[model samples]
Target chain A: MSDEGIDEGSRRDGATELLPPHVSADFYLWLWWKSEEENGKFAIDDGRGGVEVYIDDRIALRSTGEERPSAVLTGESPATTPEARAAVAGGKVPRDIRLYVRRDDRDYHVTLRGTRVSIAQAKLPAQVKSGDVAEVLYDRMFLYEELHWIVACLLRAFAAVRVTAAWREDLVPRMARWATLDEARAGG
Target chain B: MGILKGALSVRRYRVIGEVPEGFRDLWIDTLNSHQFREPQSSTHKGEVVGWAQAHNLLDTDFTDLNQWLYDRYAYFALRVDKKAVPAKLLRAHLQKRLEAWCKANNRPKAPAAVREELKETLEMELLQKCLPRVQTWEVLWNVNDGWAVFTNDAELPNERFQKLFLRTFGLRAVPWSPLDELTGTEGLAEAVAAAGTTDLRGRGA
Candidate 1:
């Protein structure tokens, strides 16, 4: 009825009918990696809550309450074995590792290995934005600290590079600032 | 009774019971001397009455009053004992009447072959209407089947859109599952391709 409604209707019709199905899958993976690198960590603390990182199905590190932690983990190349390749091609990962974190009483999971995940592919009930990666990472880190009562500052530092590498190429330069900040904060 | 008498102007009929105000126009005393008797003529009159009754234009007994009217009108002079009817049967009779009317009027009839196509068209329309409200990335992520199970986020509250997505795509909103974590664009591509292939198969089938 309204102009906006008409426009939206047309846009959706075009998107559903014209847009190729495979679009955005590769972009999402690239974006995921780039965002990871930009933040230098998968999770961060903003004087309140920090992030937790999981690598290869293991809890890699967590940030201290004093600072947020960001974590990133890259999966190994796609499984090469016949069986593994079959599973991957069938949308199942036989040998991939997963990352899971609990923060603010909520748990979030990301895959560290194998196939790239998409909201559509993962069958998640809601769409995920690039911004959510940082937020969830922070929350998971916070939960890791509270629940485990262990320091993971070094692991957090190690995972930061993985997070940064996931960002877009243009954002790489700004990531240096993030790295510097991480170092300074770690030293202090 | 008073309204029916006043409305229909029949002298031989008696109102056995009162009909609801909404069903008044639908009720008629079959035994009335003014009743028309030709089967076809009665059927046509019954149709008018049935339409009125369906729309709740008159108030009267909720019993098979519509059918009673149709049968009486269709036969023109049906026995009074045969007049009492059930509601569900009355509804079916009314539907038949409507179908006949459509045929007579040369309106498009819904065929079995076109039913699925019609449903798909309606579903697509609903989805398009819902697109803008669901523009956020979080919402989009939850749009798929397996992904929605892992991410327990709420969907946009467009009932039409929700129904369309659920019915057409087998999508449901649920908490995010661990399996979803391993997915990426490649998986999505594969899924889309699979869906496309299935669509083609369905067409051939």
Candidate 2:
């Protein structure tokens, strides 16, 4: 799959930019919009066979395999939505795009494409907080959950061994420590 | 330590001496048998072996030897002298040790917002509440002198338990019990028959 979106020249004046249309005949592209409360938009242009657009990982639109290039915009409006405008202005241009292409008869290929635009120039709403720590917390909690499972599995295995009392005793505290760490990390 | 390996190696070290003959079959031939067929080199098995060797419960050779025995016997349970240390206590201790190690590693703590989100996301409170239930199941299995017990109670003997044993321990069904290989028989008749000597009709019916 090939993605040719706006280049540095397009960012100079916010002018009518031309993104090099992606060309693929046998795959579907999905656009995901993650926001507090607004639907997102996505468009695709298939040069030969028509393209399919998926929203929230589900098929929202499917072209009739027409040779004419086509695009599907997700959400209610692609160009005039408040969320989209804010996203574009923040230079965080919806790069949450995924491409799926088909190969041969039995194989399918998937790829992630799209560029991020900086919205530093856009004025921010006074109500919106700049340093939102939720993202950071989410990431840390995810890591902790993963680590907790690992430690629990290890401890359970240790118990199954029916080993020496001394060694088992020695390792018990260690395993517990790991569990505690996992809980702490998970923000338990 | 040496005693532990010897116990594990013994074809059958009685957990409760004078257990019904069929009970042995149920434990070793059935439940224990299923435990051995679990995925190879699973973290649980590895940890068990590692702990055994580390604690001198078994010699270095004991690891390979025990594994080989598991391959041949299908399932083997060591009769640990509970007077020394109960398996539950041992497990709890090991968990504590691992927690300590995690602390020493000095990984960053989860941020408060993340903690709250994760607690909600992973249902941390629910998991914590469930931990006691899980521990209860472990205790039930450890104490019971009859057939090995499992956590999920709603699961019938022949289907879910057997499948779970196989998955958890990597042991295969020994084809000794008629229900061991039986399929499409999920009703009480099949369950009673799988129970071997349980007279479902005589006592209850």
Candidate 3:
């Protein structure tokens, strides 16, 4: 609730990185690789079946069991958006990441863009049923907690994971062939 | 604004598992098979989940003619309503009933049988006054490309939806975990395997 990740008395389910930290190139790279492997059907961990990642396939053809929608990105699909695809191929990492966390019935939706998260809801309990606003406050609290856990899980898995040096070396040449931009080339 | 708008928050799930050809027809059959059990006034029947548009499930299940076109979406909802006597109010009423029953039966704190009878009487009286609190969760399934955007994130709702989805479609909606959960890196298992004999563990072994 305080920030990303679930706070137990101690060990939480997500990454323990600082808030507002820019997502690293490695995370995207790893995600792309994983997407290629799974064919774009994967969910976010500890998401309790809440948050999921749907990959757009243009480059990686093995990610689906069927020949449907995997080849071409949909109009509004972020998976294979030009910028995102480019970034995954050899473009710079996205400026920021956006995650949408929601409860199925509650009136509010939380938008977490980068370090800032804002909840937008029209039916405030205070406006609808004016007594104690604890339910409303608690709803907000639950929303924040869920988002923090998702962000933490994502950032931690990527940032804190210790991949072998051999993998980095192997990734470089493959990346060099794909990337066009200097930042991507050097970063990869 | 609500579960149905452009500017709303939702956990996006890639619809895993094969949704067979003629999925609409299959879906209608599934919806009818798993229609929700209506809430009753007797017990603490907490919630129920099923088709948002039961009528559609009965017919062609078409929200728009565009469903026959591109970008088709289906609506589903989880409704939670309870009809239970308020515990505190029931307890107080029970106490009064118990006192009156004890006086009528000429016992200090009525025997177990008398207490049970009085409690049942009070329950019948109080059940009539109980009001069910209603909650509904709506979600959209982009049936074409296989995307399920759930509007709520509560554990109960999510769990119910998972069960409901399986019952309705015979498909698994696993909470999609990212790369780590899927492949399980365990500190780059692929890289270490590729490293072969020269790897660190190789020397130790």
Candidate 4:
């Protein structure tokens, strides 16, 4: 948790804190792409271990300009729907998504909003049922900390790859192909 | 509800500004000073907000740091109490008073100023009789990491929290968004700032 090497961006003193929220939206879209393309598997070098991400039951698509701009799809594997893929092809990015993430043996189901990357209704992995009161409290806190760490790592992985030219040149094209092919298959 | 048990919904913020020397004592003193207290009878304010223990909202005493400060994390709750008088009841009471005054004065109708005064009086009386609604949100702050997790994501509560945090800790807290984290990196600032929505359908943007 030492921010020693991490550079502070808009966080510098006297700098404006306002930041474009589109990055988070893009991250969500990227996460969706990775989840399907990479088969929900990602590795990190920080030593905490790799993460497996699964698209859950809910996904929200947002358009920057339109009369009707946002769509929320729910039920089992909403991300697999033609409408979901069509929405993306129609120039909509994911503004919110539900993901089931597994790190080590722990599992977390969380709904993430793109604007501030807010986590909602997060279901953490079960804890040991029998332990001392203090131990139980500590266990709960450890799980909470682990959840934040995994999420931060996920974002970090995305940010690391997103800033590269490959994101626009290579990654986006593949993502585009995936969206269109699936959309066409679904008769979108 | 998020801190101890139940589903978690939280907003995260990074504490800004330098941590002055003796921050431990400073935080303890600030937390104690800002402890939850009932509103005085004289003030027209119906709502009051302050800090409380995360374990028990009713407990505002933070004299023992061990109760809340665990390892590198500090745990607490934001307690808000609001007194609300039912509008219909207040209107009914005001009407009764206004009619009585008009009848005594031999006036056909109550004057606007008199009616306003009667309404205020009735409202005060009703507020006194009404119980204040109590609610609490848990906050888990990682002092070492300089970030905090607030249980509630609603606009008003988060605003209140930021204001209270600045007043108590003498620091500003900015929401830690994905952009912020990415832009914090050395070379990624410009790239992240320039990022926009991408069309993923093999379609032209």
Candidate 5:
């Protein structure tokens, strides 16, 4: 690995300019693999009892082709559906996903965009509604920062494994196996 | 402010370029120089974009550093006040004026010069009577991290904010993209450049 493509990748237009090759899509796929593999439990090293993540009802998958055809799934655990696995078998990667994260006895809902790896429309864990303006502002900022920390840790965890040879020699094969197993179960 | 309440929506940008030492006093001056002014008092129309106090939009005063600087972060709001005259209303008023001009000047229709003047007059009058629509986007800049969080997702406003940021601080605000995030990690630079998107279709499927 060299710095040859770093500048070139950044120079590309649209979402491609923001990510190395397919890293964003692969990152989401890797998350999905982890979710199912470890029953949605992730020890992100946040000091407290780690976070639990689950892919919610909404998901969008895009194929690796010139046209880049995409399938958007919504309603009741779409991530575990047969079509989702079938799409993966057809080389479709996760584009956008609704995620449910729980940590420290609190729950959060957010949308993760694979194209830029941004967390949008985040509904954070509830805190006491304070009367003081400064208190409320500080509380809000703290919650937002905590959410950002959790997300950053998740990406860091993924990057640690993703940059390794095991991702190519082991992880991808396991994920492919999982997708194929689901496809067979669905008779697709 | 969106940052203080409601569902969180933030777009982070890494502030490129360095700020000189003693930026506190410098930035306070810079912020005051770019502070919001009354559109009605000035000859400006359409919309006026400027920095406003984070706690209060009406308070354009930024003399006190304690008002905005909290710990290692700077907080402010980008205020845009827009005043627009409705097209239909302007058209109707212009038509009446045209008729009035024709009758007064003893002609079938008013001349082009007169019509232009009438339209401009009507627009200014309508603009004056109409109250401006004010919209503010909260900006929280982590001075230590060199990243700023703008509590907005709109395209046009974000573009305006970026331009204003560069003009005020003499720095470029690049969107904090995923690759940009990864590049900050110690051992990921080469790995990021080398990694390509994997297609799992052929591996086992």
Candidate 6:
């Protein structure tokens, strides 16, 4: 609001604010890296505490047990990857968390930080102005929710428990209406 | 930080308890009630108490205090306006006054009582003029999903927002953590729920 003051784009520890992922490593890797299943399914435990899903040996997702907890899926950091780490060590500026999501044939590495998230295409540049976090969030929220939809499906699959069942009953229809998934909120 | 731009530094929360009917009124009333109030020096205490207000982000005039639900989202800009007279500023005034009192009273130094008196007087005279800092926070509410995102990654603003939200909606917001993802599968949801475990996954919930 101050006309002259510098804007602190995203607060410190941007990576810490996301909800952890609750993905299955073996199933996730197979689905993510090898298979072409439209549902690319995994298990979700709507249990107490945060769940860490090792999508692969390299990337993992951590989020709250509650369906809508804040921090969405996060990937292994550039610091953890040998090549990326070496790139940083070699003075190639390492960004924040890089989430690799395979859609169709190509894989997309979505980089995320405190208030930063972007689909990194080596051709086009990553998000530059930190102030653009809001717009970027607007664009990418569905992507996170898309992953969450899978998380919800996984939660439903784990519905042998009482809580997931209740949620199943509450949500109505075993699965989310993915046809207009992003637009689902509009009707509601 | 400066009202979310391209990125949304989200503080995810799970809404506990069903939303009360006519949440629209509750939301409006609460927002109006908490809108920033101007600071004033207390004539009795001779001190200026700090005050905070929320304002509009886009409207530079800051008179836009209305709410709307469009595309299943209630879009609004939250700008928190706060003003405080730092202790050091008050202390500096006290220091100068103390010296003057000592010189006039023919004493080596002013006593605690006299210092307090001078401080009280000085605050009344100068504190009201101190300007406050303004911070803007953009909020997006997915009424369908029952979760909202603020364009900030701050502990204080987030906490304040939670308090205001509960007061407005009569529902609680648990800051989304990695732990929230694993809750409610079966007995675990019960355990956390029964224990009233807030931030069971840690982070000083």
Find the candidate with the highest lDDT and give its number.
Answer: 5
Error of 1 at A144 (Å): 19
Q: Which tens-of-lDDT digit does each residue in B1-205 have in candidate 4?
A: 4866778888877887887888777778889998998777832446788999988888998888888887777889999998888888888888889889989999999989999988887787777777788989988887887988888888778777877777787777666643455555666656565666565654533
DockQ, per-model, please? 0.02, 0.01, 0.04, 0.34, 0.34, 0.05
lDDT of 3 by residue, B55-133 (tens): 2322333334333222365655555555677789989998988888778878887878877887887877776776666
Point out where model 3 deviates above 4 Å. A1-188, B40-47, B54-70, B177-205
Error of 2 at B11 (Å): 18
Please tell me which predicted candidate would have the highest TM-score against the true structure: 4
Q: After superposition, how far is residue A168 of candidate 5 from its true place, in Å?
A: 4.3
Q: Using DockQ as the measure, which candidate wins?
A: 5
> If both were scored by lDDT, which would come out higher, candidate 3 or candidate 4?
4
- For all predicted structures, in order, the TM-scores are 0.20, 0.15, 0.47, 0.85, 0.79, 0.50
Relative to the unseen true structure, what is the C-alpha lDDT of residue B97 in candidate 3, on a scale of 0 to 100? 85
* For model 3 chain B, the run of ten residues with the poorest summed lDDT: B196-205
TM-score of chain A of 4: 0.81
Greater lDDT among 4 and 5 belongs to 5
- Please report how far candidate 2 places residue A85 from its true position, in Å: 88
Docking class of 1: incorrect
For residues B1-205, write the lDDT of model 2, one tens digit per residue.
Answer: 1111110100001122233444433443333332222224212211111111222322222324333232112222221111122346545654554455447767445445644454343333333333221111111122232223222222132233333434433332211111111222233223222222111111111
lDDT of 1: 0.27
Worst 10 residues of 6 chain B by lDDT: B196-205
Query: Per-residue lDDT for A85-165 in model 2, tens only?
Result: 333222222332332222122111122222111111111112222333333223322332222222223222222232335
- Which of the two, 1 or 2, has more DockQ? 1
Give the runs in model 1 whose Cα sits over 4 Å from its true position.
Answer: A2-41, A44-50, A53-101, A109-188, B1-159, B162-205
